[model samples]
Target chain A: MNRFLWLVRREIWEHKAIWVAPAIVIGCLVLLMLTGNVHLGPFTDMSGEAGLGVVPDDLQVKLLVIVYAGLALVVSMIMGIVGFFYSLDALYADRRDRSVLFWKSLPLSDAETVLSKFAVATVVIPMVALGASMVAQLVVAAGGSARFAIEGLPAAAMWRPEALFGGFTVTFLRCLTAMLWYAPIIGYLMLASAWAPRGPFLWAVLPAVGLWIGERVIVGSTFVGDFISSRLFGLYGVLSSRAEAGFEDGEGLEGLRNVDLVGSLRDFYASPELWFGLLAAGLLLLGAIWVRRYRDETS
Target chain B: MGELIVARGLGKSFGSTRALDDVNFRVESGRIVGLIGPNGAGKTTALKALLGLTRFEGGLSVLGLNPHLQRHRLMQDVCFIADVAVLPRWIRVSQLIDFVAAAHPRFRREICEQFLARSDVRRTSRVRELSKGMVTQLHLALVMAIDAKLLVLDEPTLGLDILMRRQFYETLLNEYFDEQRTILVTTHQVEEVEHILTDLLFIDRGRIVLDAAMDQVQEQYAQVSVRPEHLAAARSHQPIAERQGLGRTHMLFRGADRVALERLGEVGVPSVADLFVAVIQGARA
Candidate 1:
């Protein structure tokens, strides 16, 4: 376990993007908040509908949740891209620089090395993104509250501890579920990173694209395409579908309040796709370890 | 001394090109064995096989463990510097030390720090920021601190200038080597390592042409600067290799009677470089 920690630390040292990307996103979000350019369209629309033009306490809670989600969304999206490129480069970078020879000289095994990078992608990157987004959320909340105070509106409406706690919990759960859902893709990227002689990103994408096209042209079906889409965007699809279902017949702000983010996540956890993805990720990670162990450093 | 490494019929091939062919050798503890070979002569291939960085066919063991099957375990007591400047360019010197200290149970951090303190490598500088010589110094510091039983080096000083190369071997000999440890090094710069190597294994085209201790090489091989009058007599002894230089015919002989060779002219032990050339050419012939 101690060795494992050092290996992860080594990954962070080599790939600064893991932390830097999320930090940049947080900085941008904070800057946008400070500049007064953050357009809370839903908050403005709902405030206009309230009696006496005061945002209702319940509507304020809903708007605060939206604010948290929006901030978290932007940071997590950037983190997602960072994680993708990180996994592609993790195993490949050392080989490209002929540093695998140096790394392999130590007592650490290939399995430990590969798994450390995997943990950084699946666990460390998400946690960093979550933490960065939380900071961004706090700044946005404070800035929004100050704006409300200056405008002679009720700033206290956004400070309900229970509602704010719930918002944080949903964001945390979303990051966790997204991590688990994307494990297989990260595994595939690592496998490509380990196996590719060069251009690991293309190696990761082109084969799947070729398989999809081949299935369409030769097999006359979209089984591969459907599977790829479901694996790639299935979590977001379920989350958005749940939101739509919750707001189907309800009125606007009330509908937003009714969206069961936690319930949707719970449903996502219970899906067969998540379990199968975890399994595939396990196998792909083992493939990465095997390749790293046996594949000679060609350079 | 215990046998630190033993290999039999060790072989590897890349497609149709065989890098190692039915190779066999053994290294005992407390020895600095130079795995001397020309370029593409499987020097690196043999080191890779021994280091567990490549797979090979045949029985090979280091410290009683099969390198390929138990590389991680073997690495606990076996260290290597694959080549100069192979350290990751992105890591700070301090982080690299922290990592080795954490990852290698046998590594002594203070020893490494002391070594670095005497050198130009700064703790905060990234490897890429350091000169090639400094990078090698840092790598050597890390390796020397590890209390390992066997150290393998493949072209460890391939690109360094003369002063750095001299310092590299001097430091290794003075601080790192002892009877409890063994080192297997491969290099084409035969003259640089000739004096420091206690044993020599001359390999050519995947085969070991000569394997002997330095003392044995000294005792068995002799060079004679044959005068013009004794050329027929030296030729009759069938010198393994001959060249004309300094107004005389210099002939190299293996296992020939030294007393009789003295009759030809001034007799002396051939340098490792001269012996290597003579042996490689003899093998080719």
Candidate 2:
């Protein structure tokens, strides 16, 4: 385990360019919080929007919630991109730098090598991103609190300034839960790195596009739209429509309408869509391992 | 007394072309065997097979472990430096050290540091910033730190100049080498390694052409430079290879009577290059 951690640390330490993508994403989030048109004062003060004169405290809280959720989504997407490269680049970098020979010369096995890459992509990188998000949110939340306190607002609302830190932590956990949902994709990228001779990114991404296109072409005779929708988002179009209805009619998290954290995790796991992704990812990874095992060093 | 490595009738092919053909070799503990071959020879393939880096049709073993079935175990006892110096260009020296220290149980940090200290390689410097010679040094330092039984280096100093090559050999000889540690070094520069080699194997066209101790090879082979008038006598002796230069005939003879050759005409010690050419041609014939 310590050796695995060292592998992750080495990857993090060696590729300084990798840090740049996440830093840029985090920087953008901070920049948005600092300069966005939304009233920062209302979010800072323990007081709700009831005193703001225009918007109700509950409504203000909902807007803030959306903003925070959007921030989390954007951050997660950035990490996906970064994490994808992290996983994919791990194996190829050795070949690129010719260090494949060096590392292979070590006592480490191919399984260990591939697994360490998976661990970094699935576990270590998310932890780093989460830590960064926590620090960034605290600074942002603290600044807002100071602003709200100076304004001396009369009535507090549903948005709790104290909960911002809690929200950050919860969001990180949610993203981590979401990563379990995407583990195979991360693994697939790794396999692609091992399998392809040139442009692994293209190798990784092109297949999804090709499959989508192939699905459309194959289904053009019977159910064209259904195939397109399923390929676009792993969920069936009708099921997604029902889920969205449930979300909108939701008291939006109050009065028996709230999506509990564990419930969300359960719902995501129960979907056949997630299982299919896992299976597809497994096959891709197996293929990649096969390529590595028999790879010609001369090439 | 156990063998550290063994290969029997190993063969590899790329499409219709055979890259390695029925090559057999072995290394026991406490010996430095030189793997000498010309360009396009199967030296790299044979080494890669031993390291489990490439797949071959026949049998290969490292420390009694089959390369295919027990590659990880074999790797634990074996180390290899490929024909090229390959290190991550973006990685800093210090970070590389930390990585190796973390990954391998046998990696010796103190030894690596000592080697690094002797040179001007900066801890913060990225690999891309270093020269080819420096890269070789870095590679050697890392591999030397691993306490493996077999150390296989393929053309380790391909791009290095004389001074750098000398320094590399010196460091390898003084710091890391021992009889208990078996080494298989492949090189085109057979002349440079003549003194250090304990045993020599000449490989050509993916086969072992000649395998002999250095002393026996010296004793069995002779270079005879005969006058133009005595050329017929030298030819009658069945020299391995012959050339005419400046009205004199130079020929390399193996298993020939040297004293008789000296009495018949001029005779001297055969250069490794002369011997290699003669051996390769002889094997082909």
Candidate 3:
């Protein structure tokens, strides 16, 4: 575990681009918000016809809150972008540079190597981006609010700690859980990087696509479509388990309004499936280790 | 510690082609062994197998551990520098050093920093920005920082000029290497490294053709330059390899005395390159 920490730390220290990536994202978001105009539409029904020229107070407040929340998700996803590159390429870069030999020579095992990569790719990178995004979000929100005030229009709910940090923590945990649950995907990527000769990414993704296509061709089914929908809509087995727990506990959104962040974490922890996902993630991580041990580093 | 590395009938195949076949050798601690072979002799493949970077079908052990099974634990005592150009392009020299310090228990950060003063490599520049020679030196600096029982180098001085290559090896000898540490070096330019080598393993087409002490090989092989009149007699002894040089014919033969060769012509010890060529052709035959 100590060696794994050192490996993860070394990866972070070398990748200066990760530190710079979020700043670029936050800066772009701020630039967009400051120059663009915002709309509230109608206060009564958010989906109703637009009541032009007279923005009701309630309608304006909801729109402001909704837009800010949407922006937060955008920022969160953008911040999480490093995961794809970092996790997918983590094993590859070392082998490419032949540094795997150096690292392997240092009493670090293949299992440790793969797990540290998984932790960095899925856990640590997001945490770093989350912290960076929080700071940048504050700056963007403040600047946009002041600019709106200068134009004599009321700024959106830029200072709602409830909507920003509260939502971010829960969503970040959800993203983390989702990434953990899909550990097999990341494991396959590691395997691809270890074995495949020419195209690691393509080799990793193409088989899943081919299986999806083959399944459809054989059964006239839509498993891939359903799978995509489930991932995006949060209707996977983990989510279903959480829903069941939510039913038993009756704690859905109760603490959301008060921004009792710890309460929200408690609710998240209530699901037994999170532990199950973690265990499965561990197994998949072991599989990655097995593959990397026999992997030809030159390949 | 009696055996630093041991391999018995180690073999690796890729699809239909065999990269390594029935390779068997051992090295003791405190020796600088040279692994020399032609381009396709599987020198790199054997090194990878010893390091546990690739899985093979036969017996392999390093420091009493199966490299294939306990690579990480094995790595604790072994340091490797595959190529000088392999340091990450995005990292600075200082960051690489700091990273090694954090990652490896045996890495001597102070020694690395001290060597930095003598190296022409900049501590702050990104690896990709440095010239090829500088990159090799930077890599050497990092690997030298680690205190390990074994160091495996595959083409360690590649892409560096003569001066830089000399500096690199000199630093390795002065700061890092000792009687307790063993280094397995593989390179095409054997003459450059021949002076420091205590042992030699000559590989050809995935097989070890010659594994002997450097002194023993020099003692047993002789180079003879004979006139056309003596060529017939010299040819009778079946030397390892033969070639026609300017105004004379040079041949490499295995024998202590040139008594038999006196009937053929004049005899002397050939250069390492000539010996390498002769040994390779002999192995083929």
Best of the candidates, DockQ: 1
Chain A vs native chain A, TM-score per candidate = 0.94, 0.74, 0.70
Task: Give the distance in Å from residue B193's predicted Cα in candidate 3 to where it truly belongs.
Answer: 2.1
Query: Would you list the clashing residue pairs of candidate 1?
Result: none
lDDT of 2 by residue, A1-299 (tens): 78767776777776554567667766765676566433443243434554444545454554454445445555666676688677778777777757787777777767767776777777776776676666555545544544455566532332366345445645665666656666777777888899767778898778766776676688654354454344434422322233345556676334213323234455666777678867876776676676666687663
* Comparison by lDDT, 1 against 3, better one: 1
Any runs in candidate 2 off by more than 4 Å, and if so which? A29-65, A146-162, A218-247, A250-263, A279-283
Q: lDDT winner among the candidates? A: 1
- Model 3 chain B scores worst on lDDT over the 10 consecutive residues at B256-265
Tens digits of per-residue lDDT, candidate 2, B1-285, equal 568877888899878878789888777788888988888788887888887888898878788888876788887778888844677777888988888887778889999998888888889898989988888888888888889888888888888899987887777777778877988999998877777777888899888998888788889988887877777877888888997767777888889987779865678888778888888888888
Greater-DockQ candidate between 1 and 3: 1
Reference contacts reproduced by model 1: 0.85
Candidate 3 Cα outliers beyond 4 Å, as residue runs: A1-3, A13-17, A32-68, A96-99, A140-195, A232-280, B227-229, B232-238, B256-266
Query: Mind giving the per-residue lDDT tens digits that candidate 3 earns over A142-209?
Result: 77557555555445544556545644654555555546554545555666666656567787678768
Report per-candidate DockQ. Answer: 0.85, 0.76, 0.60
Tell me the tens digit of each residue's lDDT in model 1 across B1-285.
Answer: 589899999999999999999999999999999999888999888888888888899989989999888999999999999888689999999899999999999999999999999999989999999999999999999999999999999899988999999999999999989989899999888888988999999999999999999999999999999999999989999899999988999999988998899899999989888899899998998
Q: Report the CA-based lDDT of candidate 2 relative to the real structure.
A: 0.72
| Candidate 3 colliding pairs | A43-A59, A105-B75, A107-B75, A107-B76, A108-B72
Report how far off residue B283 is in candidate 1 (Å). 0.7
Cα TM-score of candidate 3: 0.83
Q: What is the interface RMSD of candidate 3, in Å?
A: 2.1
